[model samples]
Target: MDTVLKINNLYVGLKDMTIVKDFSLDIHKREIIGIVGESGCGKSTMLKSIVGLSDNNVSIQKGKIDFHGVSLRSMDQNQLRSIRGNKISFIFQKPDYTFDPVMKVKSQFFETVKFHTDGKANKKDCYKRSRELLEQLHFEAPDEVLESYPFELSGGMNQRIAVAMSMINEPELILADEPTSALDVSVQSQVVRTLMELRDKTGVAILMVSHNINVIASMADMVGVMYGGRMVEYGDAREVLQKSRHPYTKALLDAVPAMSQTMPESIEGAPPRFSEILQGCPFRERCPFSENKCETEPAIQGDASHWWLCHKQ
Candidate 1:
């Protein structure tokens, strides 16, 4: 597979607080990587690091992020800004916050176009392009959607528009942070379908962060189970979701409510506070199969494409 992104031994910290420790992953072109973990497991923190938004007291303690093989960690703020949205974009769960009530949707669309295009862009041309993007995403009334304010449209519509606008920049990778958490099931499925279709057509790599396993199972090419700032397991969707190796991964997989009586049970115990760095396997405290070996630091081991960071593995 053609690699688009590589995160090597990436450690992100806020002063003395380490949110992501020794994280690494190679993302292939056109791949949708689903990242699952309990809240505050560094999923959001890792995404922020990728987008150059890890705020206050945070710095890359030790590691590098190579986007298309260029070291993003060393890039100055200006250089990072040049790459941020034009080559990389983020889609949040809600779009209302992104749109200003004082500004029309057309204004936001043109702003997006202006950011991605040279200053010679015309308003009429941007409108045409915006409509094309909306239509591409299967929005029926593209014109109305482009004209409506954030308060006027439904939550789903605004989210779809946000997605369309993100793609308008032609980002090489989109880090979606729970883009469907607020929608109904049908709309959630629709949004996921739209994303998958866009990837199929555009070949943009996506890292979708969501706690919802069902959503990941539906859209991800690879699945990563994160717990306590560590990637417990990452593998092909088929393998990780169906035959999870790490106990934490298995417990997460089992937690999903299934029609069958044999679904895996959710692990008990709260995720450790960010101030407390993990001593051993992060999940050892909650693992049912934990042993003495788990008390010591565990290595992330296995094949290049399929691996887990666990003592038991």
Candidate 2:
């Protein structure tokens, strides 16, 4: 598969505190790479940094993000904007924040279509495509949805619309920051299915950040486990999820409730805050397998396709 996105040694910080440190990953064409981690571990920040959406206080101290051969880090505001919604799109966690409550869905969607196409596409063609995408995602009434205001629709409806909107340009890559976080279980399942179908049909690569382990297990071809703003484990999804080498990755998988198990075992102790400076392994405080070597940062272990940053591994 072709490499669609490449992130190398990225370091992102807000003012005095660094959140993402020495993180690197690659996403291939038509592939889904799921990043699963606890809140404030820089999962969302990673996505924002990729699209140049980080706040004024946030800074990319060091890194190179290449989208197909283009250097994202060197791009100016205009350059970033042109590529953001056209070549790369984002699906935010909050569906409610994505739309203008006062505007009808039709007007908002039309504006998006025009923005991506540089006003070359007519409303007739845009509407036709919109309805088709909505129908493909299992929407019963695309016409009704297009006519309704965002405030009038349910959360699930708006989320599906948000997903549909991100697909408007048929972007080469989609950065999803907990896209199903705001929905209920059933709705989350539907949205995941929709995303899977979209990938199958359009061959768009995805970099998704989610706290839900099961969601990652269901959709990701590659998986990266993050802790304290660092990638602790990364590999092919099957190996990372089933034959996990990192203690943090195993803990996350163990936390997921199973029908066969009496109860899920939650990891003890909270993830260290990014603001705190740690000398050794970030997971050392909570790692059950921690040893003397864990007091010092361990070297990464494993092959090119599967690796873990841990002493035990």
Candidate 3:
């Protein structure tokens, strides 16, 4: 598969505090890459930076974000806007925040379609495609959904609409930040299935952030485990999840609940804050496998396909 998006040695910071450090990733066509980490580990920050959406305070200290061979970091606002939503789309964590509460859903949907299509798609065509996409995601009465305001819809419904909106443009890449984190178990499963089917039908690559290991295991072709704003382990989903190489990755897997275990165990110590700069390994304090050498920062080590940032890997 051809690579759709590439992020190399990304460093995003705010007021001298780094939120993302040395983050690198490659998303291939029709593939799904799941990033799993505790909250504030820079998963969402990285997603935003890739599309030039990071907050005002956050600066791209050092990085190269390329989409389809185009240098995103070098693009101006208008240039980035031209690529955004047309070639690369985003599914924000909160659906309500993505839309105007006062505006009718139909109007907003049409506006989005028009922005991407440059007014080429008429109202009829936009509605038809939107309804079709909604129905494909198991939405009932897609017409009613379009007429109602975003606030009128339930969380799950709005989330489905968000997914539909992201798909409306038929983009080459989709960046989703915790797309299923706000839903119930059944709804989460439904959303996952919808995303899988969307990928199958459109062959669009997806880079998703999630704290749920089960969700990542179910949908991801590749997996990246983040710790203290850096990728601790990255590899084939099955290998990284089951045959984890890094101590942090192993600890994360151990923290997940299984039927065999009567009680789920949690990783010891809280994750280091984004502003807390450490001398040694960022995870050294919490790592059970830490040795005297761990007092010094470890070099990243592994094969091309599977890698880890640890001395003991």
Candidate 4:
């Protein structure tokens, strides 16, 4: 209902290749925004920039990232350290690979809690909460789970624990990058339901990033269809899915499997690679609706809510 974050012309580049530029977004309180795109379209990179983590003093170079009316551009490590993990949390794609083989589950979990929390929560309380979270996510044997190393747990268990860690913080916003991409079909629904319930109960505005159209179609309040590094279509979920504007969006929606219809064509050509120079439209090669203007610089412009850069739109 109200804007909690605003990203204006946000630009991020590693070396000379621009991963994301002129990227803007508005996130409101109590809302979920699904970011959908092909792999290597810079979706994860953008989310990583938003999370803004650093292993010491080194941080990614980024433009405007306004959170709760405060610009994050000038904020130092100490200033940013206060906001991250507590205000915004991330659920990475691969859960099993995210943990350390050497560290016990309890050790890693405690460190995560201590990092985000204002003061150290008692070990007993942390353990109690950890157990509650594990059970909440349908895991069994609380004591065994905590004592076991991440290597000892299965993929599903690690995923459940990764989600559990995020829940421990009660963050205002959650960025889930392909949260269910690696799971089996049976487990996929369970993961989706967990996210849905989390949003419903906590009112945490979620940014669910995935390449699966069907996965996000039912869960999100708003869907942001991304192409290359830019947002191609953004609107209410039903509207964007059923009535998308950009050609890329239409193509993606068409490919979604449905019982009644024949399968649609997968988009032609591969997604573009970002190089040293700032290029024109990133989706030019794959877009059937590409025009002469596509080869030139394009500004991200449209209505306040729904936006696109394509001339045809």
- lDDT to native, each model: 0.84, 0.89, 0.87, 0.76
- Expressed as tens digits, the lDDT of each residue in 166-199 for candidate 4 is 7777788888889889988677777887777777
Tens digit of per-residue lDDT, candidate 2, span 71-151: 999999888988876889888898776788888887777888787677887998888888888889889988999999998
Q: What is the TM-score of each candidate against the true structure?
A: 0.95, 0.96, 0.95, 0.87
Backbone clashes for every candidate come to: 1, 0, 0, 0
Q: Write the per-residue lDDT of candidate 1 for residues 1-313, one digit (tens) a residue.
A: 7888899989898877888987888888899999998878888788878868777777788888999988998898788877876798888767865677778888898887686566666899889888988889999998998888888988888888888888877888988988888888888988898899889999999998888889989999999988888888998998888877898877776777861248666679888887976788888778888899998988878886688887774
Which parts of model 1 are misplaced by more than 4 Å? 259-264
Q: How far does residue 206 in candidate 1 sit from its true spot (Å)?
A: 0.7
TM-score of candidate 1 to 2 decimals: 0.95
Supply the global lDDT for candidate 3. Answer: 0.87
Displacement of the residue 312 alpha carbon in candidate 4, Å: 1.9
lDDT of 1 at 65: 93
Worst 10 residues of 4 by lDDT: 53-62
Q: What is the RMSD of candidate 2?
A: 1.4
**Model 3 Cα RMSD, 1 decimal:** 1.6
For candidate 3, write residues 101-190 as lDDT tens digits. Answer: 998878887888888776787999888888899888888898999999998998988888888888887899999999999999888888
Off by over 4 Å in 2: 259-262
Q: Pick the candidate with the highest lDDT.
A: 2
Cα error of candidate 4 at position 221, Å: 1.1
Top TM-score model = 2
